[model samples]
Target chain A: MENIDFSLVDWSRAQFALTAMYHWLFVPLTLGLSFIIAFMETLYVKTGNSEWKRITKFWMTLFGINFAIGVATGIILEFEFGTNWSNYSWFVGDIFGAPLAIEGIMAFFLESTFIAVMFFGWNKVSKKFHLVSTWLVAIGSNLSALWILVANGWMQNPTGMRFNPDTARNEMVNFWQVLFNPVSINKFLHTISSGYVLASIFVIGVSAWYLLKNREHQLAKKSMIVASVFGLLTTAFVVLTGDGSARNMAKYQPMKFAAMENLYVGQQNAPLVAIGILKEDSKETLHKKQDFRFQIEIPNMLSYMAFLDPNAYVPGIKDIVHGNPEHNILSFQQRSEKGKIAIRALSDYRNAKKAGNDSLAKVSQATFEANYANFGYGYYAGRDVHELIPNIPMTFYSFRIMVGMGVHFGALFLVILLLTLKNKIDKKRFILYTALWTIPLAYIAAELGWIVAEMGRQPWVIQDILPTIAAVSQLKSTSVQITFWMFFILFTGLLIAEIRIMTTSIKIGPTEDLKDSVKN
Target chain B: MKEILFNIFQFYYQGFKSMTLGKKLWTIFIIKLVFIFLVLRIFFFPNVLKSNFKTDDQRSNHVIEQLTK
Candidate 1:
């Protein structure tokens, strides 16, 4: 703790967060829009309608711009794992790198190889072949997402890995367990579904813009029909998987769950806060309980949500920090002590091995294994209990915003779909305007989902295994700071370029002649 | 088999030759990728574990020292 550079840790985290958030802006759009474009292309092939072809090409153009930029930022994020978090890489690279390598070798190449035919093979390839290529592009993008999310989910709930004492690294024990981990499944489904919802909003919003301007009415209306239906279907999955994610969080990461609900005290039949405004409480008071300026809650809902039983006891931040004997929850202090013991035993084992005392080494190894579950807590042995708690307000508000916006987008999708079906959507100016404005809100909700996830899991890079402080590379804070600003500028420039290209393409409208289309 | 391979190669060759905006976009993509993988990676980012240690034993030893100390 004394040797640890807090500044380096903070800067490294900031850089990663910056890169991840920026990369996400382009990725979700690529994930969902590719599917939407494929569906449109499928419609064209089935019906032999040129209008559908134009519409497919229109959305495909936007997808291409987004996919290109997304790959740029994504490459940086992968490299950062090695450059910024080398220790974490060394510790879990065996398990972590497998999924990532599979993604690069299989999913990425699948996407890249097919994407050319999907884009440039418009007139060159057979219609069926082109359509299949389009579908492959969509599936490849999502498969890429699946592998990445599996790696991320493993970090949240580190299963299927065993720490080797001699190697000082976690090695993969069961690949299937890591892939099918409950946390990974829910996270993958929820994240991709959210992307589907966002892409739907993007299409509807862009189409609504055309409607507002009274241009490309047929194209706009047809796109709205497809996007709204797709959005509505995926939004349902988002909500379903979101509930699964919440349940998993409560089970696996109770502290994060508690912070999300702003719960400071343990209780049975706990209520779920629907909306709340928190007050900045003094340190002493905060340790006891967090003050809420105003809140609306549903009785027994939190208990039911967490454990599927309204009467089940849910421990809060206080209950976790200070042991809850009634519910059999160990306090942070107890865990920290166990963690310290594990650390000491590991060191002793290493020393004994060096001295050729095999008997002593074996005894130390047994001790280390017993307390290894709480090994990450060893870093916080002498720290305040407050250090164990994640930021309450950030997690709580991010959860509410993400959820509230999701509901809003779901309703918007349903309304837009129904109206489009009735042939009354274009006439409804307010609804059209709302659909148009909802694009940014959709992005905000998506970003907030990641914020709640990453921020709520504070301190730990790998849950129960590695705290972030120890995971960071031993580097100067200035180096990380310099790269952070460089990435900020580069990503921002790419985003602006993407926006300009997309807007120009949109304004050009869907036309037969590429040259005339740009001129128009 | 030779004709099939030639046809496949021709399919992509003709598609690439016919690209309008696609070529420009591909150029931008290539430039961005080169900047990221070559420039940024070479100058700013390095695989610290690989760079600092010659073997797994040394890397693990260093990490163990960090963990215990």
Candidate 2:
């Protein structure tokens, strides 16, 4: 721990966060719009409507521009896994690299190939073939999302694998368990559906702006109608899967859920904080007398969300950090103690094996097996694991913002959905304005969701299995700092270019006809 | 469904076959992508963990020493 340079870790984190946040800005739109464009292309093929073709091509043009820049930044992550977190690469690369490699071979290749065809196949190929290409591109993009998230989920709950001390890494034993991990599946659904919601909002918001401008009424209205209906369905799925995600969190990482709610003491039928602000650090509050300065909580909602039972006992940060006898929750100190023994036993076992002392090796193996579950905490030998608690204030607020934004998006889409049903969307000026304004809200919520997911799980690179400190590469902090700023500045310029290109394309609306522009 | 996919694949195969200029351009694209993603990766990013410890016993020993240190 002392050998790990703090600055190096911080700089590497900053670089990864910068690239990930930037990568996300483009990805949700790509994931969501790919499906929307496919639907539009299907409409064109089915009804033989050139207008739908125009609409699809128009969105496709924006997608292409975004896709190019997204690829340019996306490559940075794969490189960083080795360069920035070299230890992490070696430690878990056995399991983690599988999904990434599969993503490249299966999803990335499929996506890049069909995307070329989807973009350039217009005039060259038959309309049917072109339509197929569009759908394949959508599937390819979302499939790419699935594998990456599966990897992330494995980190959150390291199931389907076993630690091999000899190899000094986690190795996968059951690919199916890794693939079908409850957390991974739920996260995939929730994340991809959120993307759909974001795309819906983007499309509807842009269309509303056009409606506000009194231009492209047909395209705007049609897009708004399609996006709103689709947005509503996806939003519903997002909520369902979000519940599954929270429950998974409560089971595997209760500390995160406790932080999200700012609950200091364990309680039966724990209330969910709809919105709350943390109080100034007072001895009483920190020690579990009272936690929040102000809060609006719904009775039993947190318990319900976590366990599907209103009366289920939910552990809080205090209960979790300290041993809770009644709930049988081991304190961080206890786990830390056990983890130390496990780590030491592994060392002893290695030594005994080298010396050909079978009896000593067997005893060491037994000790290692007994305490292996707490092995990660062994690294923080002299301190309580409670000290490793994530930033409560940041995690708490980010969780609320994500949930609050989700509710707002869900409601906004439903209103638009209802209005579309009534065929009165064009007349609703207030709704149109709200839709236009809420576009940024969607982006904010999307970013906040990631903040909550990543930030809330902090101090651990892999939840309960590996702390971030142990995962970073031993490298000069200054080099990482230099690259962080380099990427930051470069991505900032790309963002400005992306915005300019997208806005201009949207303003131009669908090309008059796909005839001349469809040149191969 | 398999037959439909096969037909689609055939269409693409023949489409690439007939286009002399497009085929040449695509070949370059494939080569560049493979070089950038695969070839460069080996030199720039070697797995230090795997290379440093030659065996399970050695790797385990290193972890133990580091943790205790």
Candidate 3:
């Protein structure tokens, strides 16, 4: 702990988080809008309605603006993996690099290739070919997301890989297991569904703006209908996948699950905190207990959600840290000891091999294999046990924000859809205003979902396998800080440019030529 | 195959030539890519494992050292 440069770790984490959050802003819109545009284009081709084509082209333009900027932040994020977390790269690169490489080589190229056709092939290609290209772009972008989320899911749960004693790194054993890991599937579905919801909100919000201004009423109404229907269906899927993700979190990363609920004591029939305002606890009471100033909880809901059994025992922070014999949970201190033993065995194996002592090396190897599951805990052998606990307040609040906003968006979509169907949308300025204002909140909820996922799994870059302190590159803290600010300024600039260009395009409205063509 | 390839090439060429706002966006995209790959990556983001160690064995040894020491 004394030798570890905490400053470098903190700065690297900050820089990566900044870049990722910014990149996320554009990705969801691209994911969901591509499909929406394709659906509109499909309608245009079927009915030969120029009005549908105008709407398709209008949304496609915004998608292009977003897609370009997304690429910029995404490239920087990939580079940061090499620059800031080189140790992590080498340690698990064999397993981790596979999914990322597939994402880049397959999904990314697929998206990039067809995106041009979707954009510029409006007149150059046949209508059917162009429509196919649009759908392909949507599939390609989501495919890219699938591979990336698979990699992230692997990090959260870390399956289908084994540590190699000879290489001192984890390597892929079963590619299929890694790809189809339950965590990966849940994560992929949940993440993309949430993106779909965000994109739906974006379309509805923009269309609502036109309605509020009394411009392009037909186009706005049509778009709102398509978007609201798509949004409602995907929001249902988000809820289902969110439930699956929570179950996975409970089973695989109990510490993160505990922090999310701010549970301090182990219990059966643990209540789920629906909403809460947390009171600040002193450092002494931090892991022991958390005081919620106000909270609404559902009886036995947390237990049922986590394990499908309302009476099932759920271990909390204290139970995890102190070890619960009744629940058969090992304490962090105990795990750390096993980790140290594993670490010692590895060192001994290396020394024995160097000295050409085969028997000693074999014995040490066996010891390492036995205690390998707790290997990461070895890094905290003498450190504070409290470090095992993640940030309770941040995780708890972010989860609430994400889930609460998600429900609000669901209701908002339904209300807007009903109002639009009844032809009462124009009269209800309040609902229109709410739909318009929800654009930023949609983004906030999406970002908070990631905050809960990433931040809640704190201290571990790869859960249980490797702690973050050991995963960072041996670089000067100042270097990371410099790049952090550099990224902040550059990404901020690009975001402003995107917003300006998108708003200008929206204000221009659909071209008058399309309206004239429809009249003809 | 040759004619098909030519048609594909021609399609993209014509698309690129016909500029509205896309050309400006592409220019921004290309410029950002250049700056990122050529300048930032080359200057600040060297692959530590590849640069510091001459071989996989050496790299793995360095990681082991970091882990245990």
Candidate 4:
């Protein structure tokens, strides 16, 4: 408690964030693009349309580039668990490693092996076989995502695992419970559906560029239609999934929910902030320091969103940190005290075994079980309980930006679809230009959403059970610093090269591919 | 073998030179990345894992003891 190391923890977190941020840049594109390519290939097989095959090949080339880069950054991310967060790894590995292992053995192989077939089997295999390969690539990639999300979801809200004092680690007791966590399902669907929106926007943007250039007209028109339709469907799912994700956060991580909305007071029928700014001079606000400045709010929306009940009493940041016994919620300090009890009980149980006292051991074990739920609180008990409340302003703004982007994208996709229907896609030059630019905005939104999820869970890496400070590897900060630089250099170089190659390939276009296939 | 290699090099050489301001973009990109990842991290972030516990067992025990307290 007296001599806490801050540098090593900060550097390790920085390195992990760097790798994850880079990995994510490429992943959503791959997740969404794979399905688009598969659908195109399917239509090709169904209608025997050569144009469809060209579209598939054109996008396949880009997907390959994105997937290759994703793998490059993703490998670094997985290794970080062992190399940087060894303590968390050993503590939660029993339950955490299952989904990751399954992802590797089942999902990774399905995507990777068939990906080769999908890319190379165009001339080498039958049409149906190639189509199947394309579909497999899509299925495999999404399944891989599902498992990793399950692993992440478990970290966010640990369940199906029990702490063992003897081994000083948690052990898995229920695989099904871990696999089917509501947070995991919501996270998986919301995340992948966002990927779908991103991919559709990417497709539509590229097609829009082609229409603007007055090149590849027929191919561009059809691709835009498919992309716009795909965007529409996925954006619809994204809204529903986002709602589900917010609900799950309220249930499993009420603190995050409170911070995201910047709610400071416990109340029934809390209004959701439509848009608001945090008071900069909070100390001057005197009584209500963290309250938002002048803003728009929809009354009862937050309560209805968080809990289906319109009058459900929602606890705010203050209520969460202090006590809200009226709602049967213990203050964070009380939880910390309980966590300490759990820990002491476990220690007593261990000592009891040494003393050959069976009844004492049984009693201590029962006590440990009763209080273990607050185990994470014990680590932060001596510190300011207010620190358990994450960065309110950042979480609030990031959630708003992410949600705002999703809404804008949903509307944009509809407009694009309407223009396509009118058959005046090219005539609408201003909208076409807007479509071209929305590509980067979509990526920004996706990243902001992740920032909200991750940064909003600050202080705790394993939510309520383990603080991030207690979960890091016991390695020198210098080593992590060096590796951080190494990855920064490597991933950046790869990203630049990838863009150069991808843009060049895109500019070259699908015409040559069609000709080459026709000749063959 | 040398001729084939030369042809490959020739292809990439032209490709690189064909793009305007390619070198300038690369220079800016590398500079910004170094500043963000290395320079900025030094000023803004500090390593927290190194100061507290010297060994793995010590770290685990510290956490356990704290929880048990």
DockQ each candidate and list the results. 0.73, 0.23, 0.75, 0.09
TM-score of each: 0.97, 0.89, 0.97, 0.87
- Worst lDDT 10-window in candidate 4 chain A: A284-293
Give lDDT for model 4.
Answer: 0.80
Residue A120 displacement (Å), model 1: 2.0
i-RMS, each model, one decimal: 1.3, 4.4, 1.3, 7.7
Q: In candidate 3, what are the lDDT values of residues A7-28, reduced to their tens digit?
A: 8989999999999999998899
Taking the tens digit of each residue's C-alpha lDDT, what string does model 4 give over A1-520? 3455779888988898888888888899999999988888888889977888888878887887677555635655656775677667667857877787888887657976687578656665689888998998898889889998998899899999888775567889999999899999889999998998999999888888988999888777788888888999999999999899989899989989988888888789988899998888787432233866778999999999999888988888878887888998888889989977876788898779779999999999999889878877877768866668787778899999988888888888899889888898889999889898999998999899888999888878898888877777667889889878877887788788768867886788874467665554
DockQ of 1: 0.73
Q: What are the runs in model 1 whose C-alpha is more than 4 Å off?
A: A281-285, A513-520
Candidate 2: stretches off by over 4 Å = A2-4, A281-290, A384-386, A421-423, A514-520, B1-68
TM-score of chain B of 3: 0.94
Grade the docking of candidate 4.
Answer: incorrect
Clashing pairs in 3: none
Query: Residue-pair clashes per candidate, as listed?
Result: 0, 1, 0, 11
Docking class of 2: incorrect
Poorest stretch of ten by lDDT in candidate 3 chain A: A281-290
Best candidate (score: lDDT): 1
Q: For model 2, what is the alpha-carbon lDDT of residue A409?
A: 86
| Collision pairs in model 1 | none
